[model samples]
Target: MMKIRDVGHAIWDRPLGRIVLLLVGGLVIAVTVMLYPPLRDVVQWFLPLGLIIWGGSRVYLYGRNDLLSLISGCLLILGGITRAVFQLIPLNELAGTVANLIPVVAIFSEMFAHHYREQE
Candidate 1:
């Protein structure tokens, strides 16, 4: 039996295919938001929600890995939480996004530092 992941893999396994898929999906979402009007408010979550899920998994994995990585993952999770909360807390959207990005950028920097430590 072909699983959903296998079907997705078959369809989106190529670089061009992936880009086309993203463009098409985004277009569809854009059209839907244009049609519904109110959906634009709800649709703002696609990214931060994705980050929250990813960060949660990372936090769980890193909890067993090491202290620094666990801390970084916790920070990533916190960033996602703040981004979601900002939606309700009444801040400028661009400013909130930029502020949330700081933790993500710092986490990447820490990851790079970890990579260098491993290399040395």
Candidate 2:
């Protein structure tokens, strides 16, 4: 008897492919926000939320063995906490902003990983 193919492992293993797609997605969203003034601030806030949801979706799709999703979730949570803590710090603005976005990027990368894995 043949064993069932484990789709989750197949996709998450291709780290480079996932990273490329994530960079593309981030660029698209960033460019869109830059072009649209009204949506710019809102889009920035929504990115972290979107990343969290994307991570959850990966967990649901890939099951509990999804270490990538778990790590992404942790990074997102830490980023959120750091953002909140640094909100009052007027200095280091760029650092805080990048810190806030790290988890979002991580999750998107993981999601892309999962997506491409399924393709293979």
Which one is best on lDDT?
A: 1
Which regions of candidate 1 are displaced past 4 Å? Answer: 1-7, 66-72, 89-100, 103-120
| lDDT, candidate 2, 1-114, per-residue tens | 433455544644789757876798889988888898888867755655565565566557654665665666556556555554555466476887787677667757676666
Pairs of colliding residues, candidate 1: none
| Predictions: Cα RMSD each | 4.7, 9.5
lDDT of 1 by residue, 11-92 (tens): 7998988999999999999999999999887788765676667667666765576666566666666776777787768888
TM-scores for all predictions: 0.62, 0.42
Relative to the true structure, how large is the alpha-carbon lDDT of every model? Answer: 0.74, 0.64
For model 2 the TM-score comes to 0.42
Residue 92 of candidate 1: its Cα lDDT? 84
TM-score between model 1 and native: 0.62
